[model samples]
Target: MTAPSRPPSDVSAGVGLAGLVGLFAWLAVCRAWPAIAFHLGLATPLEPLSGPTAALAAVLFSGLAMALWSVLVDKVHRRPSTGIDWTRPRPLDEVIDISITKIAGLWATWAVIGFAYCVARWYWQGQYVFAMEVLGAAMLPLFVLSVPYVLWLDRVLVDPRDGAWHFGAMLIGREACDPEQVRIHWRAWAVKGFFCAFMISILPPGWAELTRLDWAEVFASPFAMTHWLTELLFLVDVQIAMVGYLLTCKPLDAQIRSANPHLAGWVAALVCYPPFILMGPGSPLDYHYGTADWSVWLAGWPAPLLWLWGGVLVALTAVYAWATVAFGLRFSNLTWRGTLTNGPYRWTRHPAYLSKNLFWWLSTLPFLVTTHNVNDAVRNTAIMALVSAVYFWRAKTEEAHLLAEDPKYREYHAWMEQAPTLTRALGRLLGAARRRPALQPAE
Candidate 1:
């Protein structure tokens, strides 16, 4: 048999890898800032950059690095896929009306989101408080800056009357607008409004932990090393993913071309996030009860076994993080920014989900609980299985959305069916079963 064909990726492995290098480089600088200051003989030593501001700076550093790589190396700005024609400059008077409509739509959307934040109790509580504070402070600047940005962008846009413009026209009733475009507009903003806050809230904690972690102590024990390494990888994922959510600019060639329009897709994705997450602590799908972590259960195991288990867990976490990194600045759930076929995506369709579920199983060891009760073990295992099934449902919905939106994704899907992976094996089994003749009713 001939070898399977390799489809082209929208994102190159080098682009995302460059972003990773930049992210870690900034983190290293933050960690060493105080020392650098002291060596320079400053009046006072600089404090460790481990706060929320530092975390935010990490996002900027990583995004700028990726943006530079995308422009300077990949020359992504020139791609026809960017939906821009920088060579043709439309007169300001020609595009002013279109820019105004888009600005109105964008500003109104932000206002609605702000009102929702005020009404939502969760926004004022716990980790969300920081997110709200950050957004609130940026509100004025965003409002002011958006006017010029929108006006400037409308000039070169191949089609200035995008979804946002359609939404504005619908509200004003001064121009004809497609209902479908309005829906698309709301769906895209809904994703950004909900997820951006969640991503920002989560940023500071993992960042603080990594910055403050004692490297010597971490290296002294296998458990400590694996745990912190996993944490560090997660921090990387969060930082890069946050940049993706926030930097959805057309100029960067990282705009959300379309959000998932299917109701099933939205439902599946929403349930996996906060305020709707079913697997949160004390929620319906909580499966952590009566169970011990891998380290806890393996405390009495041999050193070699402990090391091996720790290594496996770290590897799984790394794969999960790598999946996010592969997206570069275009990672977001339930949106078609671009198709990625490189990095870990080359081997599997959903590397993050696959690795994440495996990590949960190995780390939680739900079947091997501290409590001796068989019922607890059975219940935890069943709940864990259900959680995995939810992710499976999510994957299906996401696939459906992408297949409908992008032909490239469909080609990739077809290629995966014939490739020598577990997904291909499963597909072949299913295909064969479908072709098998059914047993005839007693004739």
Candidate 2:
């Protein structure tokens, strides 16, 4: 008779919970390898490696990051897992092994993309080191936040196995076993808290600018008018997205079904966030065209026509905001909430991406239209194209995930394809939103 299947590895087959923690740390390192290389002065901005000293320091930093992971796990583990639910609990060890392995595989898939990027750039020019640095730097936070953050998305007992149930539950407005389940609550709060704070911080200045807009000066000519409307649409877009965000499910009503657990998916989707790669600490790794820059495409139009073009741009952004409203409080950076089939969603599977990309094609100006330097224009255009490709990829991943959890999503998906804009579709969406059941958050 065949021997029982060999356990996956020394850790998965041997150690139990400790092995799971170690496995997570190891996968995290794989994700961060490029960044570590940079710190070692191994990437493009290479320097004299203070050989032994640098090695020692790198070892310490690696140890520290891992220690932080262990600390988080231990603290998260102290509570009774919310994953102990109405269903029969599966064997925790088996679940842990499977979850850890799957998540690790996802992170490794990101590394594969990094390697592919490196090869592409290297073949074009001898830029291996620079390419590695760019990919690694971007991948750093993506991997670090990935394992911990994704625990909220799990629908199975694996959430408890990883001690993520408490924080994950708390994040989606579920009743927590304790108020201070761990510092994860702080992390969760910091995420939404910072978003609100940033939105508020910008409003006063934005509103002031909008009011201060010189109407006569803006109407000087068609090009001038185009510029004014572009700025106006941007101001309005930001406000709507934030307002819709504030209206989303609060803890009292929100129930997170699953989070997007794939590492590449998180990275692909998050690269769209300004803080992730736009105006914040990690912004340097990405450069692309934003909606704000689109008005340049409307240059030379008559004032009336310019207004029309600007109206289209603003309308697309409104679709973005409406998707937020349709989806509701369950709306989040990476988690699954109830699927929305009405509002703009009734018109298209991905209204945000579709409208945003169409806006890009219209606005491919800035460097693309104005620059004489073909190399610079091409490179900039290519990067934005890559960014658009990432969003499309995120849409597919989201579809796959939703379909897995709810066969209803498949039926909904099919219906949208056949009769997405029918009056019946709108009626169904209206009814679903009205009738959607929400359980009370834990007492």
Candidate 3:
């Protein structure tokens, strides 16, 4: 009996030691070891700190630990078979291999760098601004939004698959058919999904809760309202532009991984349910703790009606566009994640992504009042700013990637150069009209 129990006892002992080590390291970095001491009921000479300082330190350490775990957990406990190295990805699919590698590598690096910047600062100063705190909470949503933006842009322009974007939709889409395998890997999907959901849900609550803490006098004013309204309009403009991509986009599975690997990233964003939940003060943190108006929206027949509208008018438009791209569009030779050609594709390079961003902003407007206003301005600004950069980056990447796929891309490029002619011409005409000396009759 003693011999049989030894293994179990040893395993528990090892786990306990690791947990203790992690907790100690975290507490030490934040310089707020008192909380841990209190938790353990150990009497300490130091006073316990509270308010933003303590909150900042706690969050900084928590985020840093999460980043490290995110990097390591993927390959842990799995060994490479034969000569294959688990450290180096064995290409599972032809088109996806490059995209996956780039996505994974980028995520590992981004998570580390982004978290490290915060941790190092916290160690030095022991606190961060409420704005940074709010922005930090929105990181997941911003990360989620980054993927499809990268993939769609890459498909449009052409470039080498750098794996920077973690858009993993195609990979998961393929795996969806095999539920058993997906279940096993579901943790990975969950890790990715968790971040996206955090970005969408945590943001509204963070602002709402923070407001209740008494920053109202600091953040409320006409200037604040003006800035928010300006940012809100910018957000709306960006999303409206996104609709064109949604109407005409294709499927994820059909594309080669080498070119458009981050399809999983796109799928992850959508699969986590509609971004609509994040629109108005978000789904309440506590089921019982929601705004009165929101409560009215959620109860009875109205709730079901809103859900259907959100699903059909908003979510389905994007999904349908993705399906159109997957199924193969007429007249366009682009492959899955290929050059924009179908529906809105013929007009603009990115329609679906632009639309999703627009809808997300539209939904979030009601919740952006008062203290959350600052947070909304910062988060939406960052997201839209990043989206704009992604647009140009994907185009350049796609252009380079397509060199081998279709040398005719050069011809396509030249044609596009000339093709913007009509749009450019129209713009010039409008500008000239506006400039023309306002008809003297008006004077």
Write down the lDDT of every candidate, Cα atoms only.
0.89, 0.48, 0.36
Q: At residue 8, give the lDDT of candidate 1.
A: 88
Candidate 2 root-mean-square deviation in Å: 20.3
Give one digit per residue, the lDDT tens place, for model 3 in 1-443.
22211111101122212322343354343344456677778776444333344433333333333223322442212322111223443233433544554455445555754665466443233223343554467669757875655443343223323223323322434322333332323333333332322322222322222223333542464333323333323322222212212222112111222322244333423333333232223342111112233223333555456545444334424532342322221111112223333344333444544554455444443333334456554655554445434444544444555554453444444454455433355667999999898556744
Ranking by lDDT: 1, 2, 3
1-443: candidate 1 lDDT, tens digit per residue: 77557678888777778888888998898788789778988675486678998898888888888999989888888888888999997999999999998998898889999999999899999999999989999999999999999988899889999998998898788999999998989999999999999999999998888877777978888899998989999998999999899989888899999999889888887888889999899998889988889889889999899999999999999999999999988999999988888788888899999999999999999998777999999999999999999899989999999999998898888888777876677778999999999999997
TM-score of every candidate relative to the true structure: 0.94, 0.46, 0.28
Q: What TM-score would candidate 3 get against the native?
A: 0.28
Per-residue lDDT over 389-442 for candidate 2, one digit per residue giving the tens place of the 0 to 100 score: 877888888787777765556767767655635445767899999999998899
Worst 10 residues of 2 by lDDT: 6-15
Which wins on lDDT, candidate 1 or candidate 2? 1
List the candidate numbers ranked by TM-score, top first. 1, 2, 3
TM-score result, candidate 2: 0.46
Task: Count clashing residue pairs per candidate.
Answer: 0, 5, 41
**Candidate 2 regions off by >4 Å?**
1-204, 214-237, 243-252, 278-298, 301-305, 366-369, 420-443
